[model samples]
Target: MTDHLGSCLCGTVKFEVHGQFDSFYLCHCEWCQKDTGSAYAANLFSQSAKLAWIAGVDAVTSFTLPGTRHSKSFCKLCGSALPSIQVAGLLVVPAGCLDIEITMLPTAHIFTSSKAAWGQGLRDVPEFGGLPH
Candidate 1:
């Protein structure tokens, strides 16, 4: 019954998802990496959660790969990733888009075979609380 609020980087799109996520994943597939412009996509999956747009629903745009199931929802203004429905039943929410705290961690790194060669050894890098000056 928990409600999660989310918005685009430009604040042009706002929404809420009502209910808990059933699974979380860090997808490292090439499509996910391309969609996120990162090494992986952190996504939460929910089959029963309902998405309600609070504002600017028209500002959202979605693209599904021409010959694949890969799809992405993003804000038209800032191109920030947003939530999208998949496989007709599951809702896929990008973890970074949520305004509320996420209690569930990623369950696994999926499609590791397609991960970037330079994506490994990230833990070996120095950690910082903020940008290192």
Candidate 2:
């Protein structure tokens, strides 16, 4: 198990997580794209219970996706997106937010049916129709 540290772009927010991640995932859902303003979002899957806010949790703002059960956090000052915890308490930490290099290859590409045609093709990773069980 490795301890990972991450912070928002503005350095106003930071967090740490420890233990083996369940997996890494590429989320291609519309909500992910809309929230991240990217073709997809790469995240590390881990238990939210192990996460610790090292600094500025108060500086993070959250917004729930309309008509959905998911939400995202971001730096209030710089609008830099933060990782999110889904309904089941699975923390999804953005790959870009990490201060260290993560060698964990993504385990799944989720929401394939909703993915953009020109977006990075799943190619080799396991593809899930939606959130995997």
Candidate 3:
């Protein structure tokens, strides 16, 4: 595993994570789409214990989307999305901020049923009908 660091667009928020990442992958869930204002979100998961916030917790914001217990963290200064840890304590970091290169391909794709039709053509990756739990 490798140790890495990253920050938001304005550098107001920064974090560090320890893990050997092969590469980050795209998440096509509708929540990802709406949260990122993009077609998909690039993210990678690591243990919560491996992540550390270096600065700007004061600018962090949290939101829960309607009925789902799943909540999200973001940068209030720039609206840049941040990673959230689940009850299992898995830290999911946005892949774009990684300072080190990932070596492993994404293990699988979750929420494939909600993927945009225009986002198709990823025929080789394993896909799940719903969230990959």
Candidate 4:
């Protein structure tokens, strides 16, 4: 079983996830884009992984969209994305929250039909290690 540690942007909330991830998906659904405020959401899925809050558990808050299965957990202070459990024992972990290197790459890009128009051709953009001069 692989173990991973993660935290919010401000480090106010810390957690550990234990077990191997079976799938990783980059979701481009509208809800996912809005939840992440990005082009897509990188999420790791595990059916039997265990999540344990190591610190600032009270600083975390969760929200579920009424009348829908969409939900998100975040640090109340920094508004950073955290992990959440979905139905059928699925553990969803946002890849960005992980502090350690992840050996696995996204298995697929789902919800392509709902992808933002601007989300395409991102590879054409310039790449830089840091702030460009």
Estimate TM-scores for all models. 0.96, 0.81, 0.76, 0.96
> Which one wins by TM-score: 3 or 4?
4
Instruction: By TM-score, rank the candidates, best first.
Output: 4, 1, 2, 3
lDDT of 2: 0.83
Model 1, runs deviating above 4 Å: none
**Whole-structure CA lDDT of model 4:** 0.94
lDDT of 4 by residue, 1-133 (tens): 7789999999999999999999999999999999989989999999999999999999999999999999999999999999999888789999999999999988999999998999898999999999999
Please rank every candidate by lDDT, starting with the best. Answer: 4, 1, 2, 3
Q: Model 4 residue 115 lDDT? A: 89
* Model 4 spans with C-alpha error above 4 angstroms: none
Q: What is the Cα-based lDDT of residue 50 in candidate 2?
A: 71
How much lDDT does each candidate structure score?
Answer: 0.93, 0.83, 0.75, 0.94
Worst 10 residues of 1 by lDDT: 81-90
The alpha-carbon deviation from the true structure for residue 119 of candidate 1, after best TM-score superposition, in angstroms, is 1.6
Clash pairs, candidate 2, are: none
Question: Model 3 clash pairs?
Answer: 21-102, 21-103, 22-102, 22-103, 22-104, 23-102
Candidate 3: regions farther than 4 A off: 20-25, 121-133
Number of colliding residue pairs in model 1:
0
Q: lDDT value for candidate 1?
A: 0.93
Superior candidate under TM-score, 1 versus 2: 1
Best by lDDT: 4
Which should have the higher lDDT, number 2 or number 3?
2
